[model samples]
Target: MTDVSTSDETQVDVETASESESSSYDAAQRRSRQIEADLAGDAGRYRMLTGDRPTGRLHIGHYFGSLANRVRLQELGVDSWIVIADYQVITDRDGVGPIRERVLSLLVDYLAVGLDPARSTIFTHSAVPALNQLMLPFLSLVTDSELRRNPTVKSELAASQRPMSGLMLTYPVHQAADILFCKANVVPVGKDQLPHLEQTRVVARRFDETYGRGSLKAPVFPQPDALLSEAPNILGTDGTKMSKSRGNTIEIGMTADATAKIIKRAVTDSDRNITYDPQGRPEVANLLLLAALCTGRTPQSWADEIGDGGAGRLKAVVTEAVNSTFAPIRERRAELEADPGHLLRVLAEGNARANAVAEATLDEVREAMGMAYDLA
Candidate 1:
């Protein structure tokens, strides 16, 4: 009888887990569709918060996955805020090496990719003290166990195999601070990152409930909606997620010849019959996806064009597609790289603008919590 009870409990737990996952997926889809409709009619009404950690230069994966969307949003007139989360770089690393240079390189990449400073406000993490100040109140609202349970934190801890630092444990709250500091109503993210955004939403709601004046004072932060990328998962030459650490990434700043060399080395199956079978032939399909994104066409169509031409033909086509698509951007990058002062000036202006906004938000937060002692 005891054994039967244990088995029944296990089944119940599995069923609960499955139901929870399904519910989350459904909610995400609904939110995504709503965001799309909103963007079409009133893109200017939305404020977006999205960024990268300054660990390294971005690659094609970063471009399609998020950067392209950012440029599109800016062009559509959305108030965009791009943060170089420089402080987050230490979450898993033992030391900060050449971080300053990496941050500048990231700025150069942003300009090269058409992220104009006039349209999008670009800032870094360490420069905004008021933004980081939100962490204290936010940390008080959640339990330690909740932090440990966060999926991104859990994975990072496991991968690093190091003792979880306080900053790492409270990483989600820091992200919440990042979003709420600027009152961003929309954030671009992949499906896997929905959990992180959800935590941010939780923090926003809890802060309002704990400190807000109900009907008297409106909420300080919007529960930002997720703008899921429609971009395909781009695998690297090694048939894995493209990442710098794995030496499988093709940096955006690489020359045409360098890009061609990298694509030439990409893996493909021996079947030799070119087809877009993402499940069965992911490596070949990845190359096709890259070409499709570059040319604004379908991956299957690219596959059909290269039918029976084998891997050699597919590689050549992809190499040309990638190089031509980015050739103009590389030229701009080279021109910008020559004038480093302009890049620093861009950062300085952005930092000043971000500081003003963050300061105002922090004042509002203090007022909400009745901690505005300075007003006395």
Candidate 2:
């Protein structure tokens, strides 16, 4: 009877082990399916590389443009890379000192805005040397005329009074290098950036066609797709593009009083009635939009709620809303400011992880382009 009991116990142990293994496998499969569902919502595929040129502090426009989407993407378990384009800033501006400060400030802003460092990797463009090196061979894949014909380049040049530098001209190529180096399959971009992604795909195609030895091996380059963002265009207080240089943005980290003052000074029409007519009443409409965004209420609903209020009353309501919305962010920013070293460590750790990926990609790129071991 004792021998029989031992045999039964061993059988039970083996069955329990098998069940545990099965449970783990099922959990992994469910996790993968959840990721697939998230990607399917945005068309298909995973992994995203999106960023901002750290020219100044983040504002409402940045939040509406890509930062909000980033928050959602992080929750969805997507592998996200938020690049602080420190090097790319030189294409538009001439100084590095301000850019360095902006990068650190941007890091603080990102953290305060809920970009949990545990979920997302935030790193500087210049710190990733391997990504920069990929630009050399990538430059060879496209012609000068193609670069000049890029609509983004044309528009930026027309907008800027500064002389176009070589860096500015090849800005698209550097962006291509950033995307391709990570083998990122998706890039969340605005409509204005489609041309740059197109150039990136072109480079990927060129690289593959030039050196894809088909033998069941991984391709030299994986063509990335632009995941165009569907967020609304956030207008500045002046009813134009929100820009720091234009003095139109309301800084996300500003005090409530400062934010209220900015809203009070916002441009508006002489219309007495509070209506949401964007075309005819751009300024008034902008105020309504701001209020709606702040209160988490629809513009149409807010317009009806504040009926009969003139533009002055509408501005006051909008100011209150703006102040309330950013209050938590400002508070968080103050807390982070008290411990600047902690923020630096987060950035440093992120940079090290980013560089690991960048270095591996650069090795593959150099080997494919026959640039490896020349110095050896």
Candidate 3:
């Protein structure tokens, strides 16, 4: 690395990078505002695409971070498509678990969290052939350097226990296929996922410019925009980003007793005074935030209520708040879990719907590239 203290050229390059980042942030903010306004007026006109990798059961972080937002969008009457990214499980991990089981479990979580199957088209990656088929044309639209430079890919690679697979390297392209397959115009995502969405946008633009010209349709895919989630990043019991891998998450499937136990063990500062200082007292604040989220109150207000009652009182309040909030959902989840046949049927229906949409999109893609030889 060049020393910025001694090298003027490196300093200039650093400044340019900062300016570019700032410009991108500004552009995203503008686009986000416009998308928000459009959704408010005619939400049904927008099709949203979002999903999880089916790595494991979702926790509170997944709930507030994205799942709840998904429920909100579905309730708004937006055409929602949820892809259970079962195939992407192997992107970084070497050994595979029972994906079908995980997919079913994931579905239960989605349904329990109010993601109605009727409103959102929920399907798995491996089940949708036409969706995966778009990978071939999209692969050519991007270069190796572009794929390598993607921040999400880089972070996944750095964190992976095994060597990076070809699928992992071209992960963003596959994601582009996910978005474009349904021509999804609105993708709900967090800040970290903007780069992946940007790559999807690039693919859509390049494909239209390259193929959707000269006797073909003007554009075959919508340039999807990111619908940024306003949810604050919920930290795990350990004060880090909540994750399944971290073993710190309080999963929705977990019993109330289990949740209380976990909260009791959460890390906090030595100071007994209960306060909402995220930077200074992140652990305590995280607990307060969890309680606040569950109870529909502000973290500071919760802290004020606790009023130096210390971590023990805070944990008790959080436990009750969480258990009370999720009691109904857990009951519903049990009902769903009892009927494996019904779960399978839900997957079947979702898969059928996704296949039909994907087939139509793929047909458009073929026609645009002049690959539809069957056409007279």
Candidate 4:
């Protein structure tokens, strides 16, 4: 074989070839970004990401705070996504037997609340391997101090009553994966949840800065905006924050009898009159707020109608309104539960759709990072 050493002219051609490839890669990345920006402007096809943790069945707090907004957007033809963050459950719990049941129950709650599968996608965190894999790369994009300083994580850590685990520490990274996986741009959240979304934005911006226009960031995830809730702040029966763990919640899936029982036990003052004075009598006002929010009537109006009737009257009215408002949901939940096969099918199909989107995004990421090369 005749071997020819590289001459000056040949070396220049090789350098020119390298420059051309670099230019082509840069052009390709810019085109990808411009195309995504155009797609994002399609108002009719806007994407939203929101869902419940599988702590248990969602209550009215979930309804007014976030679920109602999700349903409205879904009906408006938006690409609504409901992520059942099942992996997040293990961050606080040492067991798993109950988690599967909670996931099923949460899915049932989603259906019962009118999250139609045809219009929206509902998938679990564990089902999409692509999402989990993303966290590994995304974790590097955020700092440890940033993760620890997150209020959401801190609150959960305190309530967990257990030492922080690695999973617990990097959960914000996991959350970024969830949002970025779908490339969701619209996020419905309450004021309390703003921090979580804010951290997601930080991670997205950091990832984009490191790899976006600057470095061909694949699947440039939108820095999601928080769609804040305009609904009234809902309080529990005991005049405290409404949560399932607090035992004061009126479950949306509960039968009228069960709902009535919980409302009857709700704390109220012995003022011998019904009033909406939250500062004067928070417990009594709490019941009025519940009924008002459920019925779309003012608490003062309720107090005016129930004058001198006391706690029994207020509780009875609230129980009636609460039961009536959610009666249809309760019925649907019963039907869905009886037909577990249908529920599983919906969830499985949603998981498939989610996996498709996530896998494609992951592939683009690999290709962008020059990691998709064939070793052979």
User: What TM-score do all the candidates reach, one by one?
Assistant: 0.96, 0.85, 0.96, 0.85
Best-performing candidate as measured by TM-score: 1
List, residue by residue over 66-139, the lDDT tens digit for candidate 1: 88889999988899999999999987777767999999989999999999999899999999999999999999
Give lDDT tens digits, candidate 4, residues 277-324. Answer: 888888888788878988999999999999999888889999999988
lDDT of each: 0.91, 0.80, 0.90, 0.81
lDDT of 2: 0.80
lDDT of 2 by residue, 240-334 (tens): 88889899988888888888788888888776778888888877787788788778888888788778888778888987887787788889999
Clashing pairs in 4: 211-217
Q: Per-residue lDDT for 228 in model 2?
A: 59
Question: Candidate 1: which stretches are off by over 4 Å?
Answer: 214-216
Relative to the unseen true structure, what is the C-alpha lDDT of residue 210 in candidate 3, on a scale of 0 to 100?
A: 93
**Which runs of model 2 end up more than 4 angstroms from their true locations?**
1-45, 159-162, 214-217, 374-376
Displacement of the residue 180 alpha carbon in candidate 4, Å: 0.7
Supply candidate 2's per-residue lDDT for 290: 78
lDDT agreement of model 1 with the native: 0.91
- Judging by lDDT, tell me the better candidate of 2 and 4: 4
Cα error of candidate 2 at position 336, Å? 1.2
lDDT of 4: 0.81
Badly placed stretches (over 4 Å) of model 4 are 1-43, 156-161, 215-219, 374-376
